[model samples]
Target: MKIYEITFSPTGGTKKVADSLSNELGRDITGVDLSDNNEDLHEFSLKNEDIAIIAVPSYSGRVPATAAERISRIQGNGAKAIIVCVYGNRAYEDTLVELQDIVQKNGFLVVAAVAAIAEHSIAHKYAKDRPDKDDNRLLKEFAAKINEKLKKKDFSTPEIPGNRPYRKAGNAGIVPKPTKACTQCGLCASRCPVGAIDKNNPAKVNRKACISCMRCVSVCPHQARKINGLLLAIVNMMLKKACSIRKECELYI
Candidate 1:
């Protein structure tokens, strides 16, 4: 069966987890990077014979709205999917279920699900370097389980953790601001999925259009972009109870 790895990972954690799982499956994998600068939402397609591994990072216990919109545009072509939601040490509340619904709407049947942990994109001090060695080993075991299921053609649905109504959607449109180190290189603006910044003036961001994905802040080579310090502090304090290092990866099939 053809295996496709479709992922939206600006900070690389989600991608790393997806890659580990895909590699352990011992199948040739096709990467569909949702973060590609020139990605056209309309261009992706799948077939009934294909198996898709859809991965995305959890942003505030939900899928990034921009990535979800882009993913919704693809035709799943009746492919079976393995949905993965990777988050920082914080909870992944509704992300996996939300992603499952989105993928199914695009005509894919989700046969498996995973909620994995990765380094926090913004609060790097929290999870540190994650989907680390321990996580990788768990991912390998998860893959072996998936491979066995596929071999037996077992397609049973597994229980994915999340409340039905889901926690209310969190703040969506907070844009990152450039700090004193910004060189006006326009990288953030150009790479922004929603075109939220003025190309000529990278410092100025249209907050209404930003999805608070922290892509710009994480991708800045000079580390010039930053979220509001007060906001980060508040968020961290509120999330501290859910932020204890839960570092194992698993598969539900």
Candidate 2:
């Protein structure tokens, strides 16, 4: 069966986890990158014979609003899906459940769910070097289990973590800005999904449209983009208290 790897990763943490899991599956995987700056969304038409691994990062215990909207456009066509939610060290909360509902609504039957931990995008201090060696091993083991289950034709749904009503959505975190090193090349502006930045000037950012996903910062070749120092410090302190050091990855099928 063809394997589709769909992901929305801004800072690369979620992409790392998704790639590792796809590699372990030892299949030719088709990737759908949701990080494109353009407004175009993927239009998938999965057959019943295909399998899909859909991965997305948790934004404040919820799916990225833009990413979720894009994913809803996919036509699963009754394909069996494996839903993966990658989160910073804090918590995934209702992300998995919400993702499941979305995927199901898109005509995919979820046969598996994964909650994986990766380095925090904004609060880098928490989960500093994660989806590390241990995380990879766990992912491999999870893939093996999935392979076995598919071989047995088992399609039972597994219990996924998250609350019913979901925790209240949190406020948008810190927004990034171009540093003095920026050349005003307009790359960040052209690559901003929400068109928050002005193409003519990299320094201009419409805060209302910026989602704080750090895409512009991570994509900047000059390393010129950064969030406010004071804001980062405050976020780090809050996350440090909320996230534990010994976080683990989980799989359900």
Candidate 3:
């Protein structure tokens, strides 16, 4: 049986958790990057003997549209799947349920689910240094349980959390603007998941198109991109209380 590590991690935190769990799950693993805009997601297919670990970062407590859309294109062919939603300390309200639905609709049979905490992509203060030692241990345990289930031929779907009609996604208007330090390297444009940045003019961004995933900000080699100070401060204040107390990883099997 093959193990597929399918993920959409814009800022690396989600991928970190996914990779750790996958390492514990199996030795032979194949990666399917849902964040790559140029790839044809429909080309990927799986058989009943395959296992797919579909992981994505929770954006405002919901699955990112790009991830969701890409995930729906893959042909699961009744392969067993483990759904994982990584959040930034805050609750991942409907992300798990929504992701389960998407993958199941595409013919995956979800056998397990996980909700994990990672550092906030925007506000780095919350859940800092996460997917750390403790998280990895817990994930390893989860992987063992999943392997047991598979051995038992338990393909029953786990009860995933979240509402059917997901909460309305809040406006993600924190577009990163290139600072004077920007050299118009076009790296930001090339790496943008949504094609929000202009390739010719790195400074130019389509605000309407930007999902505010901060891929450009995180990938900037020169540290040239930045969000507005006042806006970032306001966001930090709003998330302070929710992110103050540390949250732990959760598993459903």
Candidate 4:
């Protein structure tokens, strides 16, 4: 049986959590990076014997539109899927339920679900340096349980946590853009999951299409991409309450 590790991680925090769970599952894992817009999102198909471990970060307590759209195109073909939502200390809210629904609608059987905490992509002070050593050990324990579930003949769909009607996103706050430090390097443009950045002129960003996932900012080698300082300060203050508390991981099977 093949193990497919499918993920949409912009700033690497989600991927970090995904990797730990995948590593404990088995060796020779097939990685499907959902963040790459260059890849043909619709081509892959999995057999019934295969297991798909899908991991994605929560964007404003909802599934990122780009990631959800790309994931919807994949043909699961009745393969078992383990849905994982990695969030900062802030709540994951509807992310896991939305992901479970998406994967199931795409033809995968939902067998397990996990909500794990990682360092905040935009806010470093929240859940700082997470999916830490302790989280790793706990993830391994979660993986072992998932492995056991795979052995069962009658698969039961686990109840995942989240809202049916997802919360509507607030006003478009601030989107990150390259600063004077930008070298016009095309890395940010090419690496943008939503193709919001222009490849020829990396400074140009189509804000309408941008999800503010921070992929460009995280991958920028020059430390150029950033949101407006004043707006960021406002966000920092707002999220302080939700982010100050440490959160833990939970698994359902």
Candidate 5:
């Protein structure tokens, strides 16, 4: 059976967790990058005999709007799916449930769900260097169970956690702006998942359209994009307690 690794990782943390799981699941994995706005998401189609690891990072305890929209466009064709939501040590809250609903609606048969931890995209100190050795070990174990289930032809939908009426997604008001080091190479604009940045003038960002995924900042070769120091400091303080304790990976099947 074909294995599709679908992911929307703005700053690589989510992708790191996904890679660990996917590597343990099997080989010859076909990847579908939900973060690429340039790709035609409608073109990705899966067969009934395939398995998909649909993963995304939790944005403010909710599915990223752009990722959810792109995932909804894929033709699942009843493929068995394992939903994965990666987050900082804080909490994933509604992300897994929301992602599960989206993939199911797109024709995927949900088999398993996982909530994994990764380094915080914005707050670097929280969950720093995560999806670390311990995280990978747990993810590998999760993959083994999923593989066994697939071999048994078991497609039972796991009981996913979250409220029916999901909490309203919080705004990540922090937007990265260009610094003196910005070379205007257009990389950030082209790589932005939401098309919030202007290609001609990379410095220009549509704040309203921006989901604050931090892709531009992560991809900037010159390390020129930066969030306002004061604003970031405020966020760090607010998330301090919630993100202080180390979180572990959780699997449902």
Candidate 6:
């Protein structure tokens, strides 16, 4: 059976967790990056025999709207799906359940769910260097168990947690802008998930369209993209208490 690693990870932390899970889940695992802004988001359909491990980082406790919108376009065609929601150490409140709902609506059979933690995308100090050795061991164990479940023909939908009307997603939190050091190389513009950065002049940013996923900040080769230092300091203070404590990955089958 083919395993599809479908994820929307902007800053790479969530992708790392999804990669570890996919690597152990099976051989011939294919990747479908939900972050690719240039792709035609709606072109794939999975066979019933296929398994899709759909993962997305929690954006303010919900699936990022861009991710949810792009992901909704793919037709699952009754494929078995192991839905995963990766979040910073803070919290994933409704992300996993919300994502499972989406894949199911797209015709996937929900077999299992995982809520995992990675480093904070915006404020890197939290859950730093995650999906480390111990995290990989746990992820592999989860993969093994999921494999065992797949062996059985039964495909009952698993119960996932969340409310019918998810909590409101917060406003764009940390929009990054290119610094004077920016060379208008367009890498950040090309890579912005929502096309928030101006293509011709890479330093120009449209904050209204920005999701603040930090792709520009993380992808900049010259480290020219950045958030306001004062804002970052405030965010650090706001999240410090919620992020300092270690959190473990949770699985629901």
**TM-score against truth, every candidate:** 0.93, 0.95, 0.98, 0.96, 0.98, 0.97
Where is the poorest 10-residue window by lDDT in model 4?
A: 166-175
Q: Which 10 consecutive residues of model 1 have the lowest summed lDDT?
A: 243-252
For each candidate, C-alpha RMSD in Å? 1.8, 1.4, 0.8, 1.3, 0.8, 1.1
Ten residues in sequence with the least summed lDDT for candidate 3? 34-43
Rate residue 209 of model 1 by lDDT.
80
After superposition of all CA atoms, the RMSD between model 1 and the true structure is 1.8
lDDT of 3 at 154: 89
Per-residue C-alpha lDDT of model 6 across residues 2-45, encoded as one tens digit per residue: 78999898889888988888888777987898899987867788
C-alpha RMSD of candidate 2: 1.4
TM-score computed on alpha carbons, candidate 6:
0.97
What TM-score does prediction 3 earn?
0.98
lDDT of 1 by residue, 1-253 (tens): 6898999998789999999889987568888888775877577788887888999998878888877987898899888899999988877889999998899999998889988888887777777889889888888888888888877887766787777787788874456899999999988887886788789999878878877778888878999999889888877776677776465676778
- How far out, in Å, is residue 96 in model 3? 0.5
Q: Report the poorest 10 consecutive residues by lDDT, candidate 6.
A: 171-180
- Candidate 3 residue-wise lDDT, 6-75, digit = tens: 9998889999999988998889999998877787877799999999999999988899988888898899
Off by over 4 Å in 5: none
Candidate 5 C-alpha lDDT tens digits along 39-90: 7877789999999999999988899988888998998999999999999989
Q: Per-residue lDDT for 16-68 in model 4, tens only?
A: 88899888888989989999988887678888888889999987888888888
In candidate 6, which residue ranges exceed 4 Å CA deviation?
A: none
What is the alpha-carbon lDDT for the whole of candidate 6? 0.87
Q: How large an RMSD does model 4 have? A: 1.3
User: Candidate 2 or 3, higher TM-score?
Assistant: 3
